[model samples]
Every structure is written in C-alpha cells, then in structure tokens.
Target chain A: MENFTPGASFLGGVLIGLSASLLLLCNGKIAGISGILGGLLRPVRDDTLWRVFFIAGLLAGGAILRLVSPQVFDIALTRSGEVFLLAGLLVGFGARLGSGCTSGHGVCGISRLSPRSLLATLIFMTAGIVTVYIVNTFFGGAL
Target chain B: MSTLVTSFLAGMLFAVGLGLSGMTQPAKVVGFLDLTGRWDPSLACVMLGAIAVHAPAYRLIRRRSAPIFAAAFAIPTRRDFDLRLVGGAALFGIGWGLGGFCPGPAITSLPSGHTAVLLFVPAMVAGMYLHTLVEGLQVRRSGIVHPETVSRSPTLPPSPALQYRHDA
Candidate 1:
C-alpha cells in the first residue's frame, strides 16, 4: 500500500535483468552475486580479477547512489547488532551451502526455468515468510 | 581487459537497478515480505520485471554457439535436488527475513557505512570462509582431492569421472 512503487520497481528490475543479460552474453557467466563474491574467498587463476573488479564496481555504484539518491540507503530496521551478526552468518553460510542466493537462484536461475532454482526459490521464500511471521508475532514485531 | 571492464559496468548497472527498485532500503524489502501485515507488492513487481526481460533474453543469448567474450556459457546444469540445496536455502531465508538484506543489496549498501552493513558483510565473509574450510576438511577426511586442486596440479592426470562431474 502506502509504500508500493510498482513503476520504479519494474524499471529497476528491468535494469537488473539487463545487467544480468549483459554479463551472460558477454562473459558467459551467471550474474550471481554470491557466487561472484564467494569465488573470491579462494582465488582461482584468471577468475580472480573479474570478481574483484565486479565487487569494486558494486561498491563504487553504491557510492554513486549515496551521492545521487541518498534515500535509497535509508535504514529502518530496529534489529540489534547481535541479530545482524547472526543474520549475516546465516546468509553467508546458507548462500554458499545452497550454492546460490537471491540473484543466482531467484532472479537468474528462475528466469532460465531451472527446476532446482525454482524449488530453491520456493523453499527460501517460504522460509523467509515463516521467519518474518515468527519474528513479528512472537518477538513483539520489533523487527 | 574487456571482460573486466564489462564486469565492472555490469556490476554498476546491477547496483543501480537494486537501488532504483527500492531494494537497498531494508524497510521496503521487509514491507514486501510482510504479507499478512500491510503487504507491499512492489518487490513482486521487481521480480516480474526482471524475469520478463531476462527469461527471453536468456533464451535468445543461449541460442548462440558461444558468448561474445568467452569460449562457452558457464551456466549451472545440475538437475538433481538434494538436502544441501534445501537446507542452505532455508537457512538463507531465515537470515534474509531477520536482516532484510541479501548478498547483493548488502554489498551495494556498503557505501552507506552503516553499522549493520559493516557488521553483516564481514560476518557473511567469515561464514563463506568457514564453508571453504569445512569443505576442505571434508575432502581431506574423505581422502578425495578437490577437483579444482586436482585440475590445477599438472602432475595428476585428470580423472574421467571428475571431468564428467565438472561438465554436468
């Protein structure tokens, strides 16, 4: 409702799709953010540079956003630092263990009609929904 | 050089998309996920828009014999469903719900220099490194050399079985 932004969301999504398409067509790589970043943890010959540059670009892009549209960087969550730490660990470990995250499996994999990606997406989305519900109901809706 | 440049540009474009779509805002992401409590469907729109463009583009680009800048497409071809996939995704979901930040948005939000991003990113990296350590130990314990290491070592002839696994 009050915060809905279909137009901007759609346009942004198109740009994402375009970015993925560019990576795929040009580099013959899946534009999976987790995969790219994780690959850097243990470097591979020739593979290391692209991942680094891509990540650098992400950071630079973020800096640009901070300059152009600071509103996008707003933080509204009241979650504790401990919660963030836990969440980060789970996200990092889970994304690697599962072999993909939202971008890899959700956007790119699902678009390719991969059955595994489809199932993974469903599982994660369900898990997220359930987690949110539990936190909202049981944790006094602090998050 | 071209590949690196392309990657940098693509990453930038992807970040822009995430930002423009309101993905960088944890509140917006959480709002979308809050289905039972004042649901916001804008995130759904983002997905739809991304898929609508990428699906057809993927099919088209794949029709080419090889990519413009690379020898072959490095798409994942795994078909079998397994516990690791299910379990990992579930864990990731829980974290995502708790934090409202997935890998991409989290990285893109780094310039904000927020405590959440700073705390989250390093911990996430540690988690990733931990996975590497555990996997290495598992490989060691099982007495099976990691395929990457095996391939890298010129002395060891690449096992046909390992090659098949890589292709698949």
Candidate 2:
C-alpha cells in the first residue's frame, strides 16, 4: 500500500485516455469496456476478429507487464475470487442498466458533452464513493 | 481496416494502461477504497492521468461534426436527470462497495485467467440479458411492440420512454 505512487497511476490514466481517444478517432467507438465485451456474445463475423484481438491484446499486456516489472504488478485481489466476480457482475448489470460504464460515461461520454453521459458519470462516481464509505464504515471493512 | 483497427490498437493501449497502473487487480482497487486501513489513492491517479492525457485530444474531437467510423457523431442528446439515473447509480454503488471491480476492470481482468472474472463475466452478461428480457416483456404487454422495436437504434436520440431522463 505504501509503495503506491501517483506517478504510475497518472501514467496509466494517460494511457487509458489516450487509447480511448485514439479509438474514438479511428474506430469511432466509445471504448466502453462493457460494450466491447457485450459484442462478443453476438459477434458479427466481420466484427469478431477485431474484438478477439483487442481482448487478447489486453491480456497479453498484463502478462508482459508482469514479466517486465513484477513489482509494479504486485497488487493482488484481497477478496475471495468469488466475491470479486460477483462484484464484477453487479457492475456490469449497473453499467447496462445505466447504459454505459465509467469509461463510456465517466471518460469519453463526459468529454463528448453528452447530457446522458454527464448524468451517468455522476451516478458512476457517486456509486463509487458510497460503496467505499459503506464498505469501510458500515461493514467495518468486512470485505 | 480503418476505424476498427485504430480502435483495436487503442483498446490494447487502454489495457496496457490498466496493466501498468495495477488496475486490473481487484485487491488494489479494494485496498484503495478501504479508507479505514490501506486507503489507496491509485484510482484518483488513474482518473487524473486519464483527464490530463485526453484534454488535448478531446478538444480536437469536439471540433468534428461526427467521428470517422460511424455515419454521424455518437452523442446522447437527452438533458434531464431522472429516476433511472438515480436508481441505477444506487445499484451501481452497492455493487461497487460490495465488490471492488467495476465493469472496465472486471472485463479487462477476464483474459488474465482470474477465477473471479469467470464468475463475474457471466453474471454480468446474464444481468444484461435480463434487462433486455424485461424490456421486451413490457413492450409485448403493451401491444405497441413493433414501433418500439423500430426506434431502438443507438444512434437515435434517446427517447424518455426507453430511459427516464430527469431533465424533463
């Protein structure tokens, strides 16, 4: 925990935003993680290849990073893998119900000045804040 | 070859960013939010870093009428903040607090061979299908289904009927 540095985080965010922006510039997509994964379920033959490659590249990046700088990748999931998985599902549910995720609404959506994105981003951030408060205070950090 | 390729590469870069920032791991996310103990600020850094990098690019995108890949720009025109927004946010919060992973990190983590992702991804997909199912049922019950189906394009302006917007 003490080892966490703002520099690395900032660099990572920059990369995320840049990647998102470039995707928008080139693919004209929102870089919404949910939408990308959702596409996998009913993939068009023409669209299937790119999505697979995109996802594969994501995994490869992590593996490569782990290989290059194991220290940088030291953070591990503290919760039982099951809990994290359930949490992931809920987030997905929420993102769909709300029509986008943080990347869509929080990043690209807001940047685009879409009113829906603004509202969605607000919900996303608030949910994150409340979740932290409840988990740390009410639950006594049980999770 | 054009937009898809560009976006695919961009998506890869985004994945790399998550990998580099330690976001792909749920523990760090949970630890940062732990507040009571570890209280990690890595998420903040991720947000800040993303904002800084996109500032310039955003300006350029704004100048364009529409993106290159699609026929027109992708923008949601609704202005009201309504029940759907509030309710969804509440649901999102509970889930995030209970589980450290958000949709982006959760999906990205899937290829990493994490067992949690195995559980989460399916649950997430099921949830999505359920929403669509419920909506389909509602439309059928009304006997006004065909017109509704015709109006369901992402590019179409968001209709309040499809989503309750508060700004109205």
Candidate 3:
C-alpha cells in the first residue's frame, strides 16, 4: 500500500520487543501501558515510582520523536471530539476490565504463549476490525 | 534509583519503537484494521518483529531465579477464560477501531500536543477510574476484598499470587 513502511515497522517492533525484554529482565515488569497507568490510578507503596518514571519516560520519548522525526507524528484523519471522547472512555474501561491492552496481551503475553493474552488479542483485533467495517458501511467510513 | 532509571529508559525505548513503527499514527492503525479496504500490513510486521525478539528473550529471562532488580518476576498467572476478559477486550477493540488509539499510542502521542490526544487520554483515564469505582462497589457489596485492592495496600507485600491476579 502507499502508506506501508515494513522496514520501519519491523525496526520499531524490534525496539518494542527489546524494551519489553529489558523491563522484564531488570524490573520484572511487563511493560503493559494500560496496566502501568492503571496501577498509577490506584498506587501501592514501593510500586509507584517505577510506574511514574516509566510514564515520564514515555512522555520524554514522545518529545524526542517530535524533535527527531516530526513527520511521523502527522495526523491523517480527523474525527469529531465526541468520537474521541467515546473511544477513550471505552478503551480505558475495557483495558482495565480486560487486564491488558496491545502491549501486555498482544506482544508480551503472546510472546510468553499465554492463552489468556492470546484470546484477548484475538477478541480485540476482531472487534476492532468489525467496528471499522460497521463504520465504513453504515457510518460512511468516517467517525 | 536504578529501578526508576531503568523503567524510564525502557519506557523511552518503547515509545521510540511505537513512533518508528508508525503506531502513533492513527490512520496507519486504522488502515491495518481495515482489511477490506486498501490494507496496510505494517502493523502486522510490527507485531511479528516484536514477538520474534520478545518470545525467545522472555524464555531466556525467565530462566533466572529472579529479575536483576526485583525479588521475583511479576507475571500474570491466571488461566481461566472468563467473561470479564472477553467482554473488556471486545469493548476495547471497538474503542480502538473508532478512535485508532489504544492506550500506548494515545499516551505516546501526548507529547505531540494534538487536540485529539489531549481529548482522548483524559477520557481514557476517567474511564479507568470509573472501572475502579464500580469494582470497589462490587467488592463492597460482595463483602469480599478484590485482589487488586489487596495488592495495592501497604500492609501486604506483593506476592506472586496477588501480582498474578492483577499484573496484567
């Protein structure tokens, strides 16, 4: 496709894998973004610092990306504020309820061959695909 | 000190990967999900590359008695396939497709200071808080302490069993 960049995606994926590996090896953490963030909302003693640092690091990383490759942050599609709000609510609730998101279940869990993560990944991916189909078909492909 | 620093570095590396992989771009994510449309398989490649490195690396790392910085590996150990897991995932997928922003990318995109990310992240956090509230009520009514609540209290050390229940 016109937008596909397999090489960059692959290299990025390697970095993600390495990041997850490092976190697991050093901190014994799973690098699941939602889980990390959720833990912050209801923090425990001796557990809050790493999550804070990790999240801060994420924000810093974003800043670094902005400086290094401004083009990658480009927004192609514009959705209404209502759409974003609704989607955010759903994502937040569901990720916590489900206990993981893409990184935890899709990458780390699947890599560990965890059945729960595998199932969660499949369900979420399928749901996402179905949602896109519905939006394209009924909502005129724009939300 | 080392723990926080390492966590920050790992988070930075993860964000870089997310950006380099084009994950921060909602359109690209939507394209990957839009199989019927002119699809972009870049997301698939990202997953493949990530799994290729992490799977074996995970196996190797787990061989150690303990992680370098922590006393024990805090990995999820639950095996039951329940409705909460399935239903939550489905709801999350719907949100993901509608917005093209999952938790990671949404946070990573925050530094860009985009209006969309600003709107999305706060709402996501609110939703998470709502879940906590609802779960708290449920636990209260049931007269049972949720593992999540227990694990977060200072009175108890983080046991592998408790961590397993909520570590996802």
The candidate scoring highest on DockQ is 3
DockQ for model 2 equals 0.48
- What's the TM-score of chain B for every model shown? 0.88, 0.79, 0.90
C-alpha lDDT of residue B73 in model 1: 86
Q: What's the DockQ for every one of the candidates?
A: 0.74, 0.48, 0.85
The better candidate by TM-score, 1 or 2, is 1
lDDT of 3 by residue, B75-142 (tens): 98887788889999999999999999999888989989998899999999999999878866876786
Per-residue alpha-carbon lDDT of candidate 1 for residues A1-143, written as tens digits (9 for 90 to 100): 99999999999999999999999999988888988998888776777898898898888899999999988989798798988899899999888888888888889999999887888889988898888888888997675
The digit string of per-residue lDDT tens for model 1 on B12-125 reads 999999999988887788788888887789999888888999999999999999989878888887877888789989998999889989999999999999999999888898
Per-prediction CA RMSD (Å): 2.6, 4.2, 2.5
The list of candidate 3 runs beyond 4 A from truth reads B146-165
Worst 10 residues of 2 chain B by lDDT: B159-168
**Under CAPRI classification, how is model 2 graded?**
acceptable
Model 1 spans with C-alpha error above 4 angstroms: B150-168
Model 2 Cα lDDT, one tens digit per residue, A51-102: 6666665666656665665444433544566666567566766766676776
